[model samples]
Target chain A: MPTTITVTVNGTTRTNEVDERLLLVQYLREVQNLTGTHIGCDTSNCGACTVHLNGKAVKSCTVFAVQADGGTVKTVEGLASNGVMHPMQAAFKEKHGLQCGFCTPGMIMTSIELLERNPNPSEAEIRRGIRGNLCRCTGYHNIVEAVKFAAAGTGGKK
Target chain B: MVTMTSAPFEYMRPKTVAEASRLLSKYGGGAKLLAGGHSLVPLMKLRLASPQALIDLSGVGELKGINSSASGLSIGAMTTYHELESSVEVQRAAPLLADAASQVADAQVRNFGTIGGAVSHSDPSADLPAVVLALDAVMKTATQRAGRDIPVERFFKDFLTTALRQNEVLTRIEVPKLPANTGTSYIKQSNKASHYAVVGVAAVITLGADGVCERARVAITGAGPYAVRAKRTERMLVGKKLAPNVIRNAAKRAGAEISGSFNEDVHASAGYREAMTQVFAERAITAAVANAR
Candidate 1:
C-alpha cells in the first residue's frame, strides 16, 4: 500500500505519497526533484547516496522513504543557506575537489558530517571517515585536502 | 549500476516489541525483520532475499538503548554500531565488541547498522559473531508468548542462519563484563572493498594471580562455514603463561580446529585463509595477554 509520509528535507517539511519500497535516494531525486544526491552504486559499496538522517550520515539508497517518515533529512542541497555555501562545500571548490563532479555532492555531504563529528581531524582520520564514499574521479588527494582545509576554519567565511 | 531495488513487499511498522513479535508470528517465514537494513536491503536488491512481508522494527522503542549492571550489560538490539563504538560502557565492559564494531564496514554503515541485525543475520565474515562468541554473550529473543535466552554457541547454526524461529524476534544481547585481570581483543584483515573480514580472531584471556592464564576463549570467523571456537588452542592456554612460543603453537592449531572446510572465495583461497587465521590468532592472543591486568 502507498503511504503518505512527512519528511523534513533541507529544513523544509514535505508530505508526499510514496510507494512502500521507494528508496529515500529515489524519493529525494525523482519525487522531490532534488537531483543533488546521486546514486553511484545500486549496492551500498559506493557512498554517492550519502545523506544525514537525524544528524548522522547514512546511505539513502538502502533506506526506504517510508522508514524516514517524521525524520529530519539533510541532503547536499540543504547545506547552503541564502546564497553562501557551507564551509565544506566552499573548501571543495577552493581545493579543486572535483574532476567530473559526479561524486562531488555526496563527497561534500559526507565531509561535512565528518567535520561535525571531529572539528579538527588528522589526515588519516579524514581518510577513514570518508572511506564509505568513493570518488571515481580519483581526486581523493584534493578531497582530503578540502576536508582538512574546512577543518582549519579558513576554507570559507565563518 | 544495475537498477536493483527490493521486490514489492508488505511493510509493517510495529511500535512495540510485543507487537513486532506478534506481527512476525502472523507472517511467519514470509516476514523478515528490518533493523538497520544494512545487510538485508542489499540482499533484497540483489534478489537473494525476497520476503513477502517486512516487519520494520525501527520504531520499536523497547528494542533500543543500553542498560548496564554489575553482572553484565543488556544492549537493545536496535542500537547502532556508532552507538556501540562510542559507548563508554561497551568500551570498558567489552572492548572486543567496541573494537570490532568500529571495524565494521565504514562510518556510514557503523552509523546505521545495528549489532542485533548483524548477530541475527549470522554472516560468517561479520566481525561481531566471533567477538560475541568469545565474550560468552547470551542472545535474548521474544515471541508471542514468552522470551528466551540462548547462548552464543547454539545461537548460530549455519551460514546466514540463526536459532531464531520464524515467530521470534531477537530483542537484546546480554554480554557479561570481562572479569578483573582479564583482557580481550578482536583483530581482523578486512577486505578493502566491502570491509568484511578475510580472517578475524577474537580472544579473551583472564590472568590468574600468579600471571598464569585462568581462562581462555578464542573464536574465529571468515575461514569456516560459521564462526567456531578454537577449543584446542584455548585448552592449550588455560593453565600456561602466554609465552611467545606457547602462543605460536596454539595459534597453529586454530587452522585445524575448525570443523568444516575453509571458505574459498574471490578474495582469498582456502589455504591462504588457513595461514592468515594462524597469524591473526597469534596477534589477537598476544594483544590480549599484553592488556591483561
Candidate 2:
C-alpha cells in the first residue's frame, strides 16, 4: 500500500505517495535524490543513515518514511546556508576526521545533535555521543577531535 | 544480507487511544502497534515480523507525556527514552529508570525508542525491563472492550513474550517513587557491539532508621529467557545489614529463579551469564546500598 506523506525536507515542504515500507533513509536517497546521507550500513547499527526527524537525531533505517509524515527532516545537505560549510563539516575537514568519508555525514549529523544536547561536551562525552556512528577507517581519534572543534564553535568560518 | 526496508503494511495513525484500540482489535494478530518503531520496524526490515497493518501510536495524544500522581508516575506509553532520560521529574522520581534509559543502545535509538515500546516488545536483554521489574512498576493496557493493569511481576512471561493480548495496546507504565533513605542502581555486563546487557541487575534497597536492611527489590535480566526477580537474594538482604560478605552470599542465588535453561547466544554462554548474573547482582546491591542515605 502507498502512504501519502507531506514532509518538510531540509527547508522544503513536499508531499508524495510513498510505499509504506520505504525506509526514511531510502526515501531520502531514492525519492528526494539527496545522496549526501550515506547508507554505510543498511542495518541501524552503523548509524550511517542518521538524520534529524523534527530536530531529533534518529537512525533513518530504523524509521519507516511514513513515520516522518507531517514532520521536518534535516539531513547533511541541510546543514549549510548558501554553500558555506556548517561548523561541523568545516571541523571534520580541519581536524582530519575522515579517511574514507562513508561515515562522515552520519558522524557530523549525530555530533551536531550531540552538541545541541550538551553544547560543551568533553572528549569522553563526544565519543559517547557518537558511539552509534562507526568510522570503519578507525578514524575515531580525529573524529573525536573534530567533534570537539565543532563544539568549540569558534574556528569555523561564517 | 542487509534488508534495509520494511515489508508492505497498511499504516494508520489514530488520534485517540480508544480508536487505536478498536483498530488493534479489528486487525487482531495481523496488526502491530507502532510506538517508536525502534524494535518493530527493525524486525519488519529483517523479515522477522510481517504484520498486515501497523497502528502507529505516536499520534495518539493520550498515549504521550508524563504525569505525577500520589502513588508514583503515570507515564504515557509513547514516552521516548530521550524524554525519560532528560525529564527533570523522572530524574528525581525514578532516577534508576532515567539512568537505565540513558544507557540503552545509544543516542540515536534513545531519541525515538519509548518506554512502552520497549516494555511491550519485551526483549530479554533490554535494560528497562529489569529496571521496571525492580521498581515494582505497573503496566496498563487497553482494548476495545476493557483496560487491564498488569503488575510488572506478571508482565513479562518469556523470551520476546509478555502477558499482553494480541488485541490490546499497552497504555502506560506506572513507576513508583523511591522512598526517602532508599537508593537504587542498575548495572549490566553489556555486549560491546549492541550494548544489550548480557547479564543485568537492578537493585532497590531501603535502609531502616537503625541502618539495617528494611526492604530490597532485586531483578535480573539477560541471563535467562526473561527478566526475573532474585527473590532469594531479596529475602536474604531484607532483615540483615547489607555487608559485602552478606551481599556476596545472597547474590549467588540471583539466577536461581530463571526457569528452565539460561539464554545462550553468541554474546554469552549460559555458564558465563550465570556467573556474571551473580557478580552484577552483588555489584548492583552494593552500589544501591552505598547510595542509600
Candidate 3:
C-alpha cells in the first residue's frame, strides 16, 4: 500500500504518496524533481548521495522515503539563500574544486557539515572528515583547499 | 546482480515497542526489523536479503534513550551511533563503546547507523559484535507476551545470524559498569572500500592491587564465523603479570576460539586473517592495559 507522508525539504513542506520500498534518493529525484542528490555507488560507499536528515548528513540512497517522512532534509539545492551561494559552495567555486563535477554536490554538502561540526578544522581533520564522500575526479587537493577556504572565512586566500 | 533498490515489501511503522513486537509476531520470518537500515538496506538493494515485510522501529519511543545507574547503562536499541559516540553519560560509563562506535565507519554512517541494528545483524566483520562481546553486554528483547535477557556470549550464533527470535524485538542492550582498575579497547583493520573490519579484536583487562592481571575478557571478530570470546588468551592473562612477553604469548592463542575454519573472502584470506587476529589482539590488549588505571 502507498503511504502519504509529509516531509519538510530544504525549507518547503511536501506531501507525497510513496511506495514502501522507494528509497529517499529516488523519492527526491523522481517524486520531488530534486536531482541534486546523486547516486554514485550501489554499495553504501562513494557517499555521492549525501544529504542532511534532521541536521545530520546521511546517504539518501540507503534510507527509505517512509523512514524520512517526518524528518527534515537539506540537499545541495537548499544551500543557496535568495540567489546567494552558501559559503561552502562559494569556497568550492573559488578553489576550483571540480573537474567532472559528478561528486561536487555531495562534497559541498559534506564539507558544509564538516565545518559546522568543527568551525576551524585542521588539514588532517578536513581530510578525515570528508573520507566518506569520494570525488572520482581525484581532485582532492583543491577540495581540501575549498574546505579550508570556507573555514578561513570568505576572505580571499587566507 | 547488484541493484540499487530494495525489492517490494510491506512496511509497518509502529509507534510503540509492544506494537512493534506484535507486528514481528504477526509477520514471523517474513518480517525483518528495520533499525537505521545501514546494513540491511544494502543487502536488500543487492537482492541478497529479501523479505515479505519490514517493521521499522524508528518511531517506537520506548526503544530509544539511555538510562544509567550504579549497576550500568541501559541504552535504547534505536539510539544512533552518533548519539552513542557523543553522549557524555556513555563516555563516562563505557568509554570503549564510544571510542569503538566513533570508529565504526565514516561520519555519515555514524549519523544514521544504530548499535542495535549492527548488533542484531551480527555481520561477522562489524566492529560492535566484538566490542559488545568483550564488554559483556546483555541483549534485552521483547515479544507479544514478555521480555527476555540474553548475555552476549550466547547472543551471536553464526554469520549474519543472532539469537534474536523471529517474534521478539530487541529493545535495549544493558552494559554493565566496569569495575575500578579495568580498561578496554577495540581495534580493527578495516577493509579499504567498505570499511568493514577484516580482523578486529576487543579486550577488557582489569589489573589486581599488585598490578598483576586479575580478570580479563577478550573477543575476536571478522576472522571467524562470528565474534567469540578468546578464552585461551583470557585464561593465560588471569594470573600472569601483563609484561610484553606474556601479552605476546597470550595474544598468540587468540585464534584458538574459532571452532571452525577462519572466514575467507575478498576482504582477506584465511591465513592472513588468523595472523592479523593475533596482531590486533596484542594491540588491543596493550592499548587496554595502557589505559587501565
Which lDDT tens digits does candidate 3 get at residues A1-158? Answer: 88988899999999989988888888888888899999899467898899999898998888988888888999999999999999999989999988999999889988888888788889999998888988887999999999998999944331
Report the lDDT of model 3 for residue A33. 87
TM-score of predicted chain B versus true chain B for each candidate:
0.97, 0.96, 0.97
Across residues A1-158, which tens digit of lDDT does each residue of candidate 1 receive?
Answer: 78899999999998999888889999898888899999898688889999999888889998988889999999999989999999889989999988899888888888887877778789999999999989887899999999988999743323
Question: Where is model 3 more than 4 Å wrong at Cα?
Answer: A154-158, B1-4
Q: Comparing 2 and 3 by TM-score, which wins?
A: 2
At residue B164, candidate 3 shows an lDDT of: 88
Across B1-293, the per-residue lDDT of candidate 3 in tens digits comes to 11237788988899987888788778768889999999999889888989898899888898899999999999999998988988999999999899889887788998989999999999999998998999999999988789999999999999889998888888999999998999899899988876789999999999998889999999998899888899999999998889988999999999998845799887788999999989999999999998896
Mark the 10 consecutive residues where model 3 chain B has the least summed lDDT. B1-10
Instruction: Give per-candidate clash totals.
Output: 0, 0, 0
The regions of model 2 sitting more than 4 angstroms off are: A154-158, B1-4
State which candidate, 2 or 3, has the greater DockQ. 2
Off by over 4 Å in 1: A154-158, B1-4
Tens digits of per-residue lDDT for model 1, B1-293: 22337788888898988888788778767889999999999898878999988888989998999898998889999999999999999988888888899999999999999999999999989999999899999999998789999999899888898999888889999998788999899999999999999999999999999999999999999888888899999999999988999999999998776645899999999889999999999999999999996
Clashes of 1: 0
- Candidate 3 CAPRI-style tier: medium
DockQ of 2: 0.67
